[model samples]
Target: MHPSFQERIDEVGELLQRTKAARSGFYSRIDRRAPAKPVRYQVVGGSFGMYQIKDLTTGKTRAFRNDYKAAHDLAMQFEAKANRQITVAL
Candidate 1:
């Protein structure tokens, strides 16, 4: 026998709720496998008031700067490079 109008509507609502739950579960699984954000570079003070840009992830020296201006320049250069890569990816 065909379902009444209200019965069909209720069945559809239940199916929609189940589909939404399944989709959310799938998305959560994908999110769990995604890579973490890249660590940022930092400029730290050294002896004699010098500065050095270091990669926070690898603890490697990226550049040495005699003053804040030079340090900022290096930071900007890295930022530009990252931005370019992002644009290219899209």
Candidate 2:
């Protein structure tokens, strides 16, 4: 049995709608996994003048004993690397 012209048009329209829905779902999944903001690092002060490198994105901290320069440098390095990753991901 042959499908009438109107039926064929309706089928094509339904297919188009399904394709759009599938594409949106795929992109939504990717967006959910992608970082909402660029990763950042900061040098935070701790007790007794101690310093630490803090990952602002993940809220993780690494301690350094009164070594602000080292902590700052490490934070900068992390931030740079994170920027590179974000650029590559985009």
Candidate 3:
């Protein structure tokens, strides 16, 4: 990884942390009024952890193969993915 790319990734991580911190109750289950519900994926024999990536825009829902990983990578500023199909929202 080039130094410049690494720096960009670090910056993206910082932004994600800040956003998560701003919404502490998000990933937690303490609030019954949580806006989103998690979706599950049963892939043959794979243990797929569930997560969601809301458009926070059109309010449309799509499902991903491996959600959390997809979301994390998408959060990165240096992410090189041009097509969104690799990441489906649920």
The top-ranked prediction according to lDDT is 1
- Candidate 1 regions exceeding 4 Å error are 1-39, 86-90
- Candidate 1 lDDT, tens digit per residue, 22-60? 867876988863324443777888768689888777888
Kindly list the per-residue Cα lDDT of model 3 for residues 1-90, writing each as its tens digit.
999999999999999999867666664656645444322222221355654443333444333336666654543322223222475789
TM-score: which candidate is best? 1
Candidate 3: residue pairs that collide: 62-89, 62-90, 63-89
| Candidate 2, 1-90: lDDT as tens digits | 456988999999999999877867877988864345544887888876789888777788854647888888887787777767443553
Off by over 4 Å in 3: 25-90
Error of 3 at 70 (Å): 30
- Candidate ranking under lDDT, highest first, comes to 1, 2, 3
Which window of ten consecutive residues has the lowest lDDT sum in model 2? 81-90
TM-score sort, best first: 1, 2, 3
lDDT of each: 0.76, 0.76, 0.49
Question: What overall lDDT, based on C-alpha atoms, would model 2 receive against the true structure?
Answer: 0.76
Query: What is the Å distance of residue 54 in model 2 from its true position?
Result: 0.7
